[model samples]
Target chain A: MKIAIVGSGAIGLYYGALLQRNGHEVAFLMRSDLEVAKRDGVRVIRTDDEFTLDRVAAFGDSEEIGVSDLVIVSIKATANQSLPKMLDPLVDETTQLLTLQNGLGNDQFLKARFPNNKVFGGLCFVCLNRIAPAVVKNFMKGSVSIGPSDGADASEAETLVSVFSEAGVKARFEPDLLGIQWKKLVWNVPFNGLAIAAGGVCTDVIVESPELCSEAKALMEEIMAAANQFGYTFRDGFADYQIEITQPMGPYRPSSMIDFVEGRPVEVEAIWGEPLRQAKAAGVAMPKLEMLYALLKRICK
Target chain B: MKIAIVGSGAIGLYYGALLQRNGHEVAFLMRSDLEVAKRDGVRVIRTDDEFTLDRVAAFGDSEEIGVSDLVIVSIKATANQSLPKMLDPLVDETTQLLTLQNGLGNDQFLKARFPNNKVFGGLCFVCLNRIAPAVVKNFMKGSVSIGPSDGADASEAETLVSVFSEAGVKARFEPDLLGIQWKKLVWNVPFNGLAIAAGGVCTDVIVESPELCSEAKALMEEIMAAANQFGYTFRDGFADYQIEITQPMGPYRPSSMIDFVEGRPVEVEAIWGEPLRQAKAAGVAMPKLEMLYALLKRICK
Candidate 1:
C-alpha cells in the first residue's frame, strides 16, 4: 500500500513509521522537517518498541507526493483551514483521505474539500508528542479509532484498520464515528479547555488542585448533557470514569495546552465552538460550555 | 480625629494620603512599606494633583499605633485572613472600621472579627496602582460608596464620608450597604474572574474581543439574575450599562489580573467563591460564575 501523511507531526510520523516498517511505501508531506526526514528518516520511541525508518520519501510541497492510496490528514485542527489548498494536490482517483485530527468537524471539512474522494475520520487514542524534528514520542500504547465518512463505503475503512492492527497499532473501526467523536468531546472540551484557560497546565496539574478537578468533572458533565441534547448519551459516572483514568497520567499536556505554551493559536473552534453552536441551535442549555468557548476564544487568539 | 490605615497598598495609601493632607493625625498600620513610608511619607500622583507627605507616622506592629477613631482596611482581599490579628490592636471604643477592598465578604469578615467596633464597607470607585514603595498612581477620581456593615447608625459612616469629601474625594453613605455590595458584585464577579481566567488581560482587552465582551455581558447578566434572587435587583440593561461604561477604560487590568500576574494567589473566595456558594445555597443557577470560580480556585492558589 502507498500512503501519504499530510502532516508530519507526531501522530502522522508515528503512524507513518509503523506503516513504513510494515513494508508500505510511505511519504511525508512536510514543512521544516522535509529535508531532515528524507536524509535521516523518522524516528519513533514507543513504550514497548522503538524503531527508525532508515530512508523514506519526503515532500515539502504536497503536489510532489501525488496519487497515493491513502492520504492521512493529520495536521493540527487549527491548520484545517488550509485543507482545500494543501490536500488538493495529493488526492487522486483511488486516494482515500483520512482525517486524524481533534475536535468535531474534521471529517465534514475534509470531505467537503475532497468531494470526489472518500474521506474517513481517524481518532488517535494515544498520548504522543514530537519532541524534536522528525522524532515522535509515544507516551503510551494506543489505537486508532477509524470510521467511514459520509459518501464513503464502510468496507473501505477495514483495509486501513487491518494494516494498522497488523502493525501493532490496535486499530479498530468505530461504526458509530459521530457518536465516538462526541464521546471523545466529553473528555476533550473540559480537560483541554481547563488546561489552556487555567494557566496552560497539564492534566496532572489540573487534578492536583481539588477545585480545578471538580470543575473538570463539572465541565465533563455539562458536555455530556449537551451531547444528550443532540441524541448522544453516555452512562452515569462516565465523567467520573474519565477523571479516574486521567488521574494516573501524571501531568499530561493536552494539545490545546501545548498550543498555548508554544504561543500558537488553539483549535477552540473545532473542539468547543462548533459543539457549542450545535447545542444552542438545538435549544440546549449549555452555559458551562458557552462560558468555556467564550473565554477560550479570547484567551487562545 | 486620629486615623490608622491598615493594609497600605494602593487604595490604602491613596486614601491615607488624602486624609493626611486634610489635617488629620493619620498613622499607617503597615507591613513591607512601613519603613519607607516613615522615612519619606506616603506619596500619591493623582490625575489632578500629586504630593508627597514629608512627615507621616508608620508602624509595622499594629500594637504600636494603639487605638484610633478610624481604621481603614485597605489591603488586598487575599490578605484579609490577617485582619483579626493585625487590626485587633488598632481598634478602640469609638474606632469605626472601614473595609475598602475588592470582592464580596470583607465587611462580613471584618465585622465578625471586630464585633465591638462599628464597621463600614467602602467601595472605592477609582482606578489606582502602587507604582513604587510608598507612591500610588491614581488613574481616575471617583466617589467612595460608604455603608454601615451591621445595621449600625448611618452616621457612623458619615464621619469618614465627611473626611473623604473634605479631602476632595466624593463620598456618600448608602442606607442599604449590603445592597450596594451585591450591586458591586454584579460587575466584580465577571470582570475579575474573566481577567484572571482569560489570560490576565485587562478590561479593555476583554472588550476588544467581541466574543469575550459579549460573554462578559452574559456573565454579568447571570450574576444580576443571581443577585435578583436575593432581592437586589437592578434596572433593565444594567449589564449593558456596565459594558458601555467599561469599554472606554482602555485595557485596564482589574485587581485579579494584577494578582495573577504578580504571582499572588487570587482572592477567589471573597470575590467568586463566596458569591457562588451563596447563589447555590439560594437555589439560584449561576453556572457561568460557578465555572469561573472553579477554574480560578485552581489557577490562583
Candidate 2:
C-alpha cells in the first residue's frame, strides 16, 4: 500500500511510522522540518520499541508525493482552508482520503474539494504529542474507528483496517463514523474547553474542584442532548465515563491547553465552533458549548 | 454623621475620601496601609482634584474604630468569611451598614454577621484602581444605587443616599436592590468571566470579538431568565442596554479581572456561585453562569 501522511504532527508521524515499518510505501507531506527529516529520520520515543526511521520519503510539496492509495489527513483543523489547495496535487479519483482530524465539517470540506474521491474519517482515539520537529511521543492509545463519511457501507474500510492492523495499530471499521465523531465531541467539548477556560489548568485541578467537575459533566450531558436532536443518542453517564477514563492520566492537560501554553492557535473552530454551529442548525440549545466556543474564539485565533 | 469605612481598598478609600471632604467624621479601618495612610493620608489622584487628606483618622483595628452611626463595608466579597469576626467591634445596633461591594450576597452576608444592625447594599457603578497603598485612582464613574436587599423599604437607605450625594457621589436609592444586582450581574458574569477566560484581556478585546459579544449578550439573557424565575422580570434587550453603557469604557478591566491578576481570590461565591445557586433554587438553568463560576473557582482561588 502506498500511504501518504498529510501533516507530520503527532498522529501523522506515529501512524506513518507504523505503516512504513509494515513495508508500506509512506511519504510525509512535510513542513519546515522537511530538511531535518530528510537528514535524520523522524524519531518515535516509546518505552517498548523506540526507533528512528529514515527509510520513508519526506516531500515538501504535494506534487512531489503524487497520488497514493491512502492519504491520511492529519493536519490541524485550523489549516482546513488550505487542505484542498495543499492536497490537490496528490488526490485523484481512486484516492482514499481518511481524515484523522478533530471536528464535524472536515468530511464535507474534503468532499467539496474533491467530489469524486472516496473520503473516509477515522476518530483516532489517541493521546500523543509532537514534542519537537520530526519527533513524536505516543503517551497512550492509537486506535482508530474508521468508516465512509458519505454514508457508503464500507468494505473499503475493512481493507484499510487490515493495512492498519498489519502495522501493529488498533483499527476497526464502524458503519456509523459520524456518531463516533459526536461521541468524541462529548469528551472534547468539555475537557478541552474547561482546561483552556480555567486558564490552562489540568485534570487534577478539574477533579479537585466539585463545581468544575459537575460543569464538565453538565457540558457532556449538553453534548448528548444536542446529539439526540440529530437522532444520535449516547448512553447515560457518558460524561462520567469520559472522566473515569481521563482521571488515570493524572494532572494531564489536553491539547487545547498545550496550544494555549505554546502560543499556538488552538483548533477551537474544528473542535468547538463547528459542533456548536451544527447544534444551532439542529435547533438544539447547547448553551454550554455556545459559551465555551465563544470563550475559546476570544482567547485563541 | 460619624462614618467608619471598613476594608480600606480602592472602593473604600475613594468613597471615604469623598465623605471626609464632605465634613463627615470618617475613620478608616485600614489593612496593610495603616501606617502610610496615617503618615500621608489616603490620596485621591483625580484629574480634576487630587488631594491628600491627613485630618481623617485611620485605624488598623476595628475595635479602635468602635461602633459608628454608619459603617460603609467596601471590602471585597472574598473577605466575607472574616466579616463576622472583623466587623464585630465596628457594627452596633444602630450602625447602618452600606455594602459598597461587588456581587449578590454581600448584604445577606453582613446581615448574617450583624443581625441586629441595618444591612443595606450599594451596587456601585464605579471604575477605580488602587495603584498603591491608600492611593486610589478614580478612572471613571462613582454612582451607587443604594437600597435594602431584603425587600424592606427602609428610611435609612434614603438618608444614606443623601450623605452619598453630598459627598459628590452620584447616589440614588433603588427600592428594588436585588433586581439591580441581577441587572449588574448581566454585565458582571460576562465581562469578568470573559476577561479571565480570554487569558485576562480587557473590554476592548471582548468588544472586538463578535463571538464574545454575542456570548456575553447571551449570558445576559440567561441571567435575566434566571432572575425572572425569582419574580424579577427585567425588560427584553437588557443585555444590549448594559453593553451600550459598557462600550464607552474603552479597554476597561473589571474588578474581578484585577483581583485575578493580583492573585487575590475572586468573589466567585457572591458574584457567580450564589446567583447560580439562587437560579437553581428558582428552578432556572443558567448554564453560562455555572460554567463561568466553575472556571473562576479553578483559576481565581
Candidate 3:
C-alpha cells in the first residue's frame, strides 16, 4: 500500500516511518521542516526502540505527490479548518482518507470536504511528542481504531487493519466508529480542557486534588450523557477507565495543554466548543462541559 | 481612651497610627522586625496625609503591657490560632477585643479561647501594605464594620464607631454584624480559593477565562445560599460589587494567592474548609465551594 501521511508532525512521522519499514511506500506531505528531513531523512526515538529511516519521500505541497492507496490526516485540531483545502490534491475515488485527529467535529468537516472519497473515523490512544523537526519520541504504546465514516462494507476496514498490523502499529477495526469517537470525545473534552486551563500535568490534577478530579469526571459524565442523548451508548466507567490508564503515563500533558503553554492556538472549538453546541442542540443539560468549553474559549481568545 | 494594637503588620500599624492620631493613648504590639519602630515610634503614610507619632509605647510581649480600653487584633487569619494566648495580659474584662483579621471562623475561635472577654467582629475594607518597619502605605480608603459578636448592647458598637471616626478610619457599627461578616465571607471564599488553588492573580482568574469567572460566581452563589440558610440576608449584587471594586485595585493579589506564590502556609481551613463544614451542617448544598475547598486543601498539602 502506498500511504501519504499529511501534516508531518510527531504522529504522522512515527506512523509513516513504521509503515515504510514494513515494505509499504510511505511519503510525508510536509511543510518547510520536511525539506531538511528530505536531505537527512527522519529519526524516531521510542522508549523501546529507535530508528532512522533514510528512504522516505517528503513533499512541501500535496500537489507534488502522486496518487496513493491511503492518506492519513494527523494535523492538530486547530489546523483542521485549512486542512481540507490543503488535502484537495491527494483525494481520489479509491483514496481512503483517515483522520486520526483529536476533537469532535473533524470527521463531519472531512466528510463535507471529500464526500465522494471513503473517509474513515480514527482515534489514536498513544502519547507521542516531537523532540525535533524529524525526531519523535513515543512515550507509551496504544492502539488506533478506524472504521468507515458512513457505515460501509468491512473489507476496506480489514485491509487497513492488516496494513497497520503488518507495520507493527496496533490498529483495530470498529463497526461503530462513532461510538469510539464519542468515547474519545468524552475523555478529551474534560482532561484536555482542564490541562490547558490549569497549566499542570494530569497526575497533578487527578491525584493531588480530589475536587478537580471529581469535577473533571463530572464534566466527562456530562459529555457521555450528551452523547447518549444523541443515540450513542458509552460503556460504564468510560471516563474513569481513561483517567486510570492515562494517569500512569508519567507527567504527560495533553496536546491542548502543550499548545496553551507554548502560546499557540488551541482546539477549543472542536474539542470542547462544538460538543457543547451539539449537547445544547439536543436539549441535554451539560453544565460542566458548558463551563469547561466557555473557560477554554476564553483562554484561547 | 487607651488602645493596644497587636500584630503590627501593615494593617496593624495603619490602625495603630490612626488611633494614636485620634488622641488615644496608642501602643503597638511589636514583633522582631519592628524593633526599630519600637525605638523610633510608629509612622503612617496615608493617601491624603502622612505623620509619625513619637512616645507611642511598643511592647514585644503582651504581658509587659498595661490594661487597655480596647485591643485591636489585626493579624493574618492563619496567625489567629495562637493570637488569644498572645493577648492574655493585655485583654481585661473591660477590654473589648476586635478582630480585623480576614476570613471566617476567627471570631468563633477567639470567643472560644477568651470566653469571659468581649469579642467584637471587625471587617476592614481597605488596602494597605507595609513599606517599612515603621511605615504603612495606605493605597485606598474604606470602612470597617464592628459590632458585638453575641448580639449584645449597641454601646460597644457606638464606642467603636466613635473611635474609628476620630482616627480617620471610615467605620460603621452594624447591629447585625454577622450579616456583614457573612458578606465578606462570601467574597473571600471564592476569590481566595480560586486564586490560591490556581496559583494566579484575581484578575487573571476572573477576566482571562469565562469558565473560571463562572466557576467563581457559582462558588460565591453557593456560599451566599449557605449564608442565607444560616439566616443572613446579603445585599444584592455583592459579588459583582466586590469584583468591580477589586479588579482596578492595581494588580493587587489576594493574600491566599500570595501564599501560593510564596509557598507559605495557607489559611485554607478557615476561608474554605470551615464554611463548607458550616454549609453541610446548615443543610445547604455547596458543590462548588466544597470542590474549591478540597482543591485548596490538596494544593496546600
Candidate 4:
C-alpha cells in the first residue's frame, strides 16, 4: 500500500518511517526538512530502538506524492488552514484520510474538506518530538487510538487500526470518535494547557506542585463531566489514572508547551477551544475548561 | 498622632509622606530603604504633585519607631510571617492598627495577633510603585476604602477615614470590612490575578485582548457571585465599572504583576487564595476564581 504523509513533523515522520520500514511505500510531504529528508531520508529514535528509513520517497510538493491508498494528516491544528491545498493533491475519492492530529475538529475538518473520502482520526498515545529537521525522537511509545469520523463505517476504523498494527504500532479501534477524543482531552486539556499556562514548565513541575496537581485533576474531572454530558462517560478513577500515568513522564515537555516555548504556533483552538465550544453547546458547564481555554487563547497565541 | 509606617514599601511611603506633610509626626520602619530614606527622606511623585520629606524619621528596627497612635501596615501579604515581630514595637492597646495590604486575610491575621488592639483594613484603589529605595510613583490616585475588622467599632473606621482625609489622601469609611474586601476583590481577583497569570501582563494588555478582557469580566462576575453568597451584594454593572476603570490605566502593572516581574513575593494567598477559601467556605461557586487561584499559586510563587 502507498501512504502519503502530510504535515510531516515528528508524528508524521515517526509513523511514516515505521510504515515504510514495514515494507509499505511511504512518501513524506516535507517543508523545512525537505532537503535533509531528500538527502538522507528520515530518522526515528526511541529509548531502546532507533531506525533510519534511507532513500524513502520525500516530496517538497504534495502533488509529487500524488494520490495513494492512504493520506495521513499530522499538521498542528494552528496550521490547519493549509490542509485543503496540501491534502488536495494527494487525496482521491477512494483514498482514506487518517488525521493523526491532536485535539478535536481535525477529522471533522478533513471530512468537510473531502466529503467523499473516508475520514478517520488517530490519537497517538505516545510522546514524540522532532529534535531536528528530518530527525524524530520517541521518549515513550503507546498505542494509537483510531476512530471513524461521523458517518464513516466502524469497520473502517478497524481496518486503519490493523494498518497501524501491521506497521508495528499497537493500534485499537474506538467506535466513538468523540469519546476517544474526549478521553485524550482528559489528559491533553490539563497537562498540555498547564504546561504552557504555568509559564512553560514540564510534567514534573506540574505533578510535584500540590496546587497544580489538584488543578490538573480538577481540569480532568471537568473534561470528564463534559464528556459524560455528551454520552462519553469514563470509568471511575479516570482522573487518577491520567495523573498516575503522567507521573513517569518526569520533566517531559508536552507538545503544546514545546510549541509555546519554542515560539511556534500552538493548536490552541482545536485542543482547547473546540472542546469547550462543543461542551457549552451541549449545555454542559465547563467553567475550569473555559477558564483554561481563555488563558491558553491569550498566552499560547 | 505619631504614626509609624510598618512594611514601608510604596503604599507605606506615599501615605506616610502625606501624613508627615500634614503636620503629623511620621516614622517609617525600613528594610533596604533605611539608609537612603534616612539621608534623603522619602520622595512621593504623582502626575501633578511631587514632594520630598527633607527630614523624615527612618528606622532600621521597628523598636526605634516605638509606640504610635496609628501603625499603618503596607507589606506584601506574602511576608505576613514577620507581622508579629514588625508590628509588636509600634502597635499597642491604643495604637490603632491599620493594614493597607491587598486581599482578604491581613486584617484578620493582624486582629488575631493583637487581640487587645483595634484593627482596620484599607483597600487602596490607587496605582503606586516603589520606583527606588525611597521613591514612590503614583500613576493614578483614588480613595482608600477604610473599614474596621471584626469586633472593632464602626467609630474606629470613621476616625481612620478622617485621619487619611486630613492627610490629603482620599478616604471613605466602609462599615463592613469583609464587604469592602470582596468589593475590592471584584477587581483584584481578575485584574491583579490575570496580570500575573497571563504571563506578567499589564492592565492594558489584559484589557486589549478580547478573550482576556472577557475573561477579566468573567472573573469579576464569579467574585461578585461569591460575594453575594456572603451577603455582600454590589449594584448591577459593577463588573463593567471595574473594567471601565481599568481601561484608562494603560499598561499599568497591578502590584501583583509588578511583584511577579520584579521577582518579589506576590500576595497570591492574600489576593486569590484567601478569597477563594472564604467563598468556598460560604458554599459559593467561583470556578473561574478557583482556577485563577490555582494558576497564581503555581506561577506567582
Candidate 5:
C-alpha cells in the first residue's frame, strides 16, 4: 500500500515510519522538519525498540506524493485551512482519508471538502511527542481506535485497523464515530484543557488537587451527558475510570498543553469550541465544557 | 473615632490614611511596611487628590494599637485564621469590627470571634494598589458599601457609613450584606477568576473577547441565579452594566489577580469557595462559579 502522511508531527512521523518498516511505501509531507527528515530520516525512539527510516521519501510539496492509497492527516487542527490544498494532490476516488487529529469536526471537515473519497477518523490514545526535528519519542504506545465517518463504510475502517496491526500497532475499528469521539473527549476535555488552564501544570497536578480532580470529573460527566443526547450511553463510573487511568501518567504534558507552552497555535476550535457548539445544538447543556472552552479560546488566542 | 487598621494593604492604607488626615487618630497594624509607615507615614495618591499623613503611629503588633473605637480588618481571606489572635488586643466589647475584604464570610468570621462587638462588612469597589511600601496608588476611588452582619443593627451600619463619609469617601449603607456580596461577585468571580485563570490578564482582556465577555456574563447570570434563591434580585441587564462600567478602566487588574501575579495568597475561600458552598446549600446550581472556584483553588495553591 502506498500511504501519504500529511502534517508530519509526532503522530505522523511515528506511525508513518512504522508502516514504512512493514513494507508499505510511505511518503511524509514535511514543513520545518523536511531537511531533517531527508538528512536523519525520521527516527522513532521507544523504550524497548528504536528505529530510523534512513532514506524514506520525504516531500515538501503534497503534489509530489500524488494519489496514494491511504492519506493519514496528523496536523494540528489550528492549521486545518491547509487541508483541502494538501489533501487534493494525495486523495483520489479510491483513496481512504483517515484523520488522526484531536477533537471533533476534522473527519467532518475532510468529508465536506473531499466528498468523493472515503473519510475515516482515528483517535490515538498514545503519549507521543516529537522531541526534535524528525525525532519522535513514545512514552506510551497506546492503541488507536479507527472509525468511519458519516457515509464511510465500517469494513473500510476495519481494513485500516488491520493495516495498523500489521505495522505492530494495536488498532481497533469502531462503528460509531461520534460515540468514540465523546469517549476520547471524556478524558481530553479535562486533562488537556486543565493542563494549560491550570497554569501549565500537568496531569499529576490536576489529579492531585481534589478541586481539579472533581472539576475534571464534572467536565467528563458533561461530555457524557452530551454524548447521551446523541444515543451514546457511558456506563456508570466512566468518569472515575478516566481519572484512574490518568493517575500513572505522572506529570505528563498533554499535546494541547505542549502546543500552548511552546508558543504554537492550539486547536482551540476543534478541541473545545466545536464540542461545546455541538453539545448546545443537541439541546444538552454542558456548562463546564462551555466555560473551559471560553477560557481556552482566550488563553490560546 | 479612634481607628486601628489591620493588614495594611492598599485598601487599608488608603482608607486609614484618609481618616487620619481628616483629624481622626488612626493607627496601622503593619508587617513589612511598618518601618516605612512610621518613617514617612502613609501616602495616598489619587487622580484628584493626594495626601500624606506624617508621624502617624504605626505598630507592628496589634497589641500596641490597643483597644480602639473601631478596628478595620483588611487582610486577605487566606489569612483569616490569624484574625482572633490579631484582634484580641485591638478588639473590646465596645470596639466595632469592620471587614473590608472581598468575597463572603469575613463578617461571619468576625461575628463568631467577637460576639459582643458589632460586626460590619464593607465591599470596596475601587482600583487601588500598594505600589511601594506605605505608598498606595488609587486609579479609581470608587465607593464602599457597608452592612451589618447578623445581630448587628442597621443604624450601626449607617454610622459606619457616616465615618467613611466624614473622610470624603463615598460610602453607602446597605441593608443586605449577603445581597451586596453576591452583587459584587457578579463582577468578581468572572473578572477576578478569569484574569488569573486566563493566564493573568486584566478586566479589559476579559471584556474584549466575545467568548470571554459572554463567559463573564454567564458567570454573572449564574451568580444572579444563586442570589435569586436567597431573595436577592438584580436589575435587568446587570451583567451588561458590569461589563460596560469595566470597559473604561482599560486593563485594570483586579485585586485577586494582583495577589496571584505577585506570588501572594489570593482570597480563594472568601471570594470563590465560600460563596459556592453557600449557593449550593441554598439549593441553587452555580456550575460556572463551582468550576471557577476549583480552578482558583488549584491555581492559587
Candidate 6:
C-alpha cells in the first residue's frame, strides 16, 4: 500500500515508520523540522523496539509529494484551519483521508474541505511525545479507531484496519464513529483540560485531592450528559475507564500543560471550546467543563 | 497603648513596625526570622517612605512578651490550629485579640481558645508580600475591618478603631462583623481556591476565560446563597466588589498559587472545606463552593 503521512510529528512518524518497516511503501509530507529527519532519518523508540530508517523520503512542501492510497492528517488541532491548504496536493479521488488528531471538530473540518474524499475519523489512544526532531517516544500501548465520518461505507475503515494491522498497530472499525470521537473527547475534556488548568499530573491530582477527583468526575459527567442530550449513549463507565487509564500514567503532564509551560498556542478551542459550544447549543449546562475551558482559553490567550 | 504582634510574617511585621513608628510601643512575638530584626531592627518599604527601625523589640517566646492591651494575630490560616498555645501568655483579663488572617474560622478558633477575652474579627484589604525577613513590600493600600465576632458589643470595636488609627493603619469598626467576614469569605472562597486549583494568576483565569469567570462568579453566588440560608444579609454588590477588586490586581498570583509553586501545605480546609462543611450541615447545597473545596483538598493532598 502506498501511504503518505501528513504533518509528520511523533504520531505521524510513528505510524509512517511502522508501516514502512512492514514492507509498505510510506513517505512523510512534513512542513517544519524535516531537515533533522532528512539528516538523521526517523528514529522511533518504542517499549519493545528501537529502530531508525535512514533513507525515508521527507518533504517540506506537500505539493512535492504526489497523492497516495492513504493520507493520514495528524497535525495538532490548532493547525486544522490551515489543513485544507496544506494537504491540497495530496488529495485525489481515491485517496482516503484519515484525521488522527485530538479534540472535536477536526473530522468536520476535513469533511467540509474534502466532501468526497472518503474522510474518516481516526483516534489514537496512546501516549506519544516527540522527544526531538524525528524522534518519537511511546509511553503507552493502545489501539486506534477508524470509521467513516459521514457514516456511509466501511471500505475505507477496512483498508485502514488492514494497513495498520500489517504494521503491528491494532486498528478497529466502529460504525458509530461520532460516538467513538465523543468518547475520546470525553477522556480529553476532563483529564487533559483539568490537568492543564490545574498544572499537575493526573494521578497526582486524583490522589492528592478528593475534591479534584470528584470535580474531574463531575466534568466528565457533564460532558457525558451533553453527549447524551445529543442522543449519543456512551458505554457504561466510560468516565471511570478514562480516570483509570490516566491514573497509572504517573506524574505525566498532559500536552496542554506542556503547551502552557512552553508558552505555545494550545488547542483550547478544539478540545474544550467546541464541545462547550455544542453543549450550549444543546441546552446542557456544564459548569465544571465550562470553567475548565474558560480557564484554559484565558491562559492560552 | 502597649501592643503585641503575634506571628510576624509580612503583614504582622509591616503593621507592627508602622504602629511602633507611630509611638504606640509595638512589639513582635516572632519565630526564628526575627533574630535579624532584633539585631538590625525592622525595615518597611512603603510607596511614600522607606525607613529602617533601629530599636525594635523581637521575642521568640510568647511568654517573654507578657500581657498587652491589644494583640494582633497575623498568621496564615494553617497556623490557626496552634494559635491558642501561641496566644496563651499574651491574654489577661482586659486583653483584646484581633485576628487579621485570611479564610474563615480564625475568629471561631480564637474565641474557642479564649472565651473570656474580647476577640475581634479583622480583615485586611491591603496587598503586601514579604520581600525578606522583617521587610514588607506594600503593593496596595486598603482598609481593615475590626468588629465583634458574636455581634454583641461596640466598646471593643471602638478601641480597635482608635488603636488602628493611632498606628496609621486604616481600620473600620463594623457593627456587623459577621457580615464583613462573610463578604471577605466570598472573595477568598472563589479567587483563592480557583487561583490555586488553576495554578495560574487570578487575572489570567478571569480575563482569559469567561467560563472560568462565570464559574468563579457562580461559586461566589453559591457562597452568598449559603449565607442567605443562614439568615445573613450580605451588602448589595459584594460579589461585584470582589470582581472589581480582584481584576485590577493584574496577573498577581495569590498565596495559594505560591503554596502550590513552592510545594508548601495549603490552607484549603480552612478556606473552602470548613465553609462547605458548614453549608452542608445547614442543608444548603453550595455546589460551586463544594466543588471548589473538593478540588482544592484533592490537589493539596
Tens-digit lDDT track of model 2 for B179-281: 8788778888889888987779888788778888887887788889987776677776677877887787888888889888888888888888888898888
**Worst lDDT 10-window in candidate 3 chain B:** B199-208
Give me the TM-scores of chain B across the candidates.
0.95, 0.94, 0.90, 0.97, 0.98, 0.92
RMSD of each: 2.2, 2.7, 3.8, 2.2, 2.2, 3.4
Q: What is the per-residue lDDT of model 5 for residues A1-301, given as tens digits with 9 covering 90 to 100?
A: 9999998999999999999999999999999999989988989999799998899799999999899999999988989988889988897789999999999989999999988889999999898889999999998889999999999999989999999999999999999988889889888999999998887899999999888898899999889999999888988889999888899888889999999999999888887889899999989888888889888888898
- Please give the interface root mean square deviation for model 3, in Å: 4.2
On residues A1-301, what C-alpha lDDT tens digit does candidate 1 reach at each position? Answer: 8899988888889898988888889889888788888788899997777888889888888888878888888888888777778877777777888988888889998777778888898888788888888999988776788998877878888877898898778889877677778888887898899898887889998777777787788778777877787677788889889888888778888877887888877888999998888777878777788788888887887
Which candidate number maximizes DockQ? Answer: 2
lDDT of 2 by residue, A96-177 (tens): 8899998788987887887788888888877777888888887676588898878544998888888888888889998777
Q: Model 5 misses residue B291 by how many Å? A: 0.9
- Clash counts per candidate, in order, are 1, 0, 0, 0, 0, 8
Q: Model-by-model lDDT, in order?
A: 0.83, 0.83, 0.76, 0.88, 0.91, 0.78
The DockQ of each candidate is 0.73, 0.75, 0.24, 0.67, 0.74, 0.39
The RMSD (Cα, Å) of candidate 5 is 2.2
Instruction: Name the better of 1 and 6 by DockQ.
Output: 1
| lDDT preference between candidates 5 and 6, better one | 5
Question: CA lDDT of B166 in candidate 3?
Answer: 82
Tens digit per residue, CA lDDT, model 5, B21-115: 88899989999898988899888899988888888789999888899999999987899998889999998789999999889888989998898
Supply fnat for every model shown: 0.81, 0.86, 0.19, 0.69, 0.74, 0.40
Q: Give the runs in model 5 whose Cα sits over 4 Å from its true position.
A: none
State the lDDT of candidate 4 residue by residue for A165-262, as single tens digits: 99899999998888889899999999999998888899999888887888899899888988998789788899998889899989998999999999
Location of the lowest summed lDDT over 10 successive residues in candidate 5 chain B: B48-57
Q: Which pairs of residues collide in model 1?
A: B204-B251
